[model samples]
Target: MFERLISYLDSVRARDPAPRSRWEILLYPGVLALGLHRVAHWLFEARLYFLARFVNHFSRALTAIDIHPGATIGKNFFIDHGFTVIGETAQIGDNVTIYQCVTLGGSNPTNGKGGKRHPTLMDNVIIGSGAQIIGPIVVGERARVGANAVVTEDVPAGATMIGLKARSTLVPAEDWLREFIPYGTPCDDPPCDEQGSPRRDCIEKLEAEITSMREEMALMKAMLAECAAPPTPVRIRKSAAKE
Candidate 1:
């Protein structure tokens, strides 16, 4: 058990450089919360429902992290900061890291039956701060959920998800090969298009519209010129003096 604790602290240290020592990491709210959660979960599994809830609430009060006792968590799971909520049906796998203010929220069932409503995060997944991964979606292995993303569907393995209603894009091979990415996103000082180029199709469509407008204006000018042309002088045949 002591070795396992050391291993967990080492894992956290590897991810976070701020911690000067394992002792400081031990003082982190996330670490304390996780430790309490183990007891809560154990009580929950033993069918000590009230005791489990009591422990859960106490842990939340102390750490500001809410993890339901019924949630299933695996080895070396790390919550980098507080204000994270894990729903009862959420299942987490090994080496998963979640930043502050993340939610593994559950879905409302119309059938009124309890089931797996929360998300399942596969091993090596990283969730950035303020990300909301709602419903029974599966976040595949090695996937990254960027900060402030709202995800409602299953994410593919090794994909990077960003933006609201989270859009999944495959990371470049070089970036993907890196073991860890801070904030689960690539740093862009100035945000650029994913392909690093302007949108040619939209530019072309605008140019085409401008050309059509110019053609219409030219046609209108020709029509107006014809209409404004002076009527050819009517040649009145000189009436032979009929008087």
Candidate 2:
């Protein structure tokens, strides 16, 4: 418990630029909320349904972050702000970061009970502020979801999901870890085509353009060689001069 608390503080300090004191971090709403959620989850898993709900209610009243007791969350997790909603069927892996107003909820709002209604986020996933990941989808390891993205499908590992409709592009997870993404995810865009597809599409276009230019250059060189070549010898004029 002591080691985990220290790790939590260290993670927050590393990610957040603000000067932090032990007291401040200890009093942080996110920390309190996570701790409360832990106890609630234990109770829920032990089949203490009513007690688990009561503890969750108490936690939400204090922190304003609603994490369902049935949700399975792993270690070194940080919820950056209040009002974040983690659904009942949501499963979160270790070293995950979630910003304020993020929702991991079911896509079919009309029906509540089913198998795997909420999304499962793998280790090292970062979810930006206000992003909504709905349905039974899996966000792969080290994936970054940009702010306000509406993602319903699976996101690949080590990729960045950007834009309103959410487009995935490959990016190194190491590069993303060094900076404080803080869930305000932004990075250098890989070359993309008109449809926002990756550099693969652009590569074909560039190659076609290069081929056209090379053909034009070859034709110009042939014309130049023809012009530079000497005219056919005038044999009749030479013979007349000799005579």
Candidate 3:
């Protein structure tokens, strides 16, 4: 238990940019909620439902973040700014980072008796602030859900999901965040290339298409000219009708 505490504190210090003493982990609402959640989860698993609920309530009070004890969360998980939510059936994998106002919630609230209701976040996944990952969707490993994005479908691994309905994909080279971010990981498109200029691939493709279209137009003009021209008089050698 002490080792787990140390690890949780270490994660908070390493992941957050807030300058603080090591002992100050005690006051961190996200860290505090995680500490209480450990006990609450144990109690819940032990079938002590009331006690678990009580502990969960206390944790929520301490930190505005509300996580059901029934949710299965792994190690090195960090939640920033609290007020984030994890539903009962939500399963969070190791090293997942969630920002404030994020929700791993159920899309269908009416039927809650059986099966997985919430989203499953895979390892190294990051959820931006205010992003709502609803339903039983699976967010693949290393995927980033952009802030304020409403996601109901499964996200592919290493994908950057952004906007309301655009769902455009950035290149793998641009989407991968190998290092830790001070705050929550960003899910938006990366800046211009290393040279600070826009990528040339799209422009090159457009130019190639324009060239092809010009060639097609030239061929069409040649065909039209041929069709409009006077027919050449056939110099058919007149043979004396049947020698």
Candidate 4:
């Protein structure tokens, strides 16, 4: 346990290197708060409700991050630039990166009890800054939740979800990585025809040509099949008057 603690401390130090000047690297109270919250979260899970609440209150007082003790967070979870709020029932998977101002809260409209109230985030999900993922939805693995996106439904695996209700584009990760723009940009060009023309008339002409070619090919194949078939024997009954 000591070795693991030391190792985690080392990793945190590496990520947040001590600044040359003391004032430059102010040790965020949120870090210690996270540590205590982890312990409190464990206690809550272990059915030590009173103790867990005590620790939770202490941690919140110190860091101002309002994470409910019932929330299930996985390993190596880092919450940067605090003031982040997670609901009581939020389920976060492993290696999920959440930035500042991200909210994973309950969207249950009814004041009714006993139902899933928070979002379920899958593994390796990267949520950009200020993203608001709400409701009882499952965000799939390796999905990128764009900044300030209001996702209300289940996001598919390896998808990039964006927009008001989060419309997903089936763009591969490699293509997304190649782009320099951080946020998504809309295309301005008008739709093109099948034959690479701006005019609809050209598209219609091409479609007609393709349809005609298909019909001609079908007719030719039927003729070839008929020719390849064995010839039927002709009945050679002698002409009635010839005999």
Please, what is the TM-score per model?
0.78, 0.73, 0.72, 0.62
In angstroms, give how far residue 156 of model 4 lies from its true place: 1.3
Each prediction's RMSD to truth: 7.6, 7.8, 10.3, 15.2
Of candidates 4 and 3, the better by TM-score: 3
Model 1 Cα shift for residue 190 (angstroms): 12
TM-score winner, 2 or 4:
2
Please name the candidate that would achieve the greatest lDDT relative to the true structure.
1
Q: How many pairs of residues in model 4 come into backbone collision? A: 0
Better of 2 and 3 by TM-score: 2
* TM-score of candidate 4 on Cα atoms, chains taken together: 0.62
TM-score of 1: 0.78
Where is model 3 more than 4 Å wrong at Cα? 109-112, 166-168, 173-177, 181-243
Per-residue CA lDDT of candidate 2, range 1-243, in tens? 788688888887676666367567777778898899999999999999999999999999999899999999998788887889999999999888898899999866565657788999999899999999999899998888988988989998877787778877556555555544657476444422333554535679899999999999999999999999999885678768899
Better of 2 and 3 by lDDT: 2
Worst 10 residues of 4 by lDDT: 186-195
Which tens-of-lDDT digit does each residue in 10-68 have in candidate 4? 43444444535433323555456667878988999899999998988887777777788
Residues 31-113, candidate 1: write the lDDT tens digits: 99999999999999999999999999999999999999999999998999899999999999999999999999999999999
Write down the lDDT that model 4 would get.
0.70
Put the candidates in TM-score order, highest first: 1, 2, 3, 4
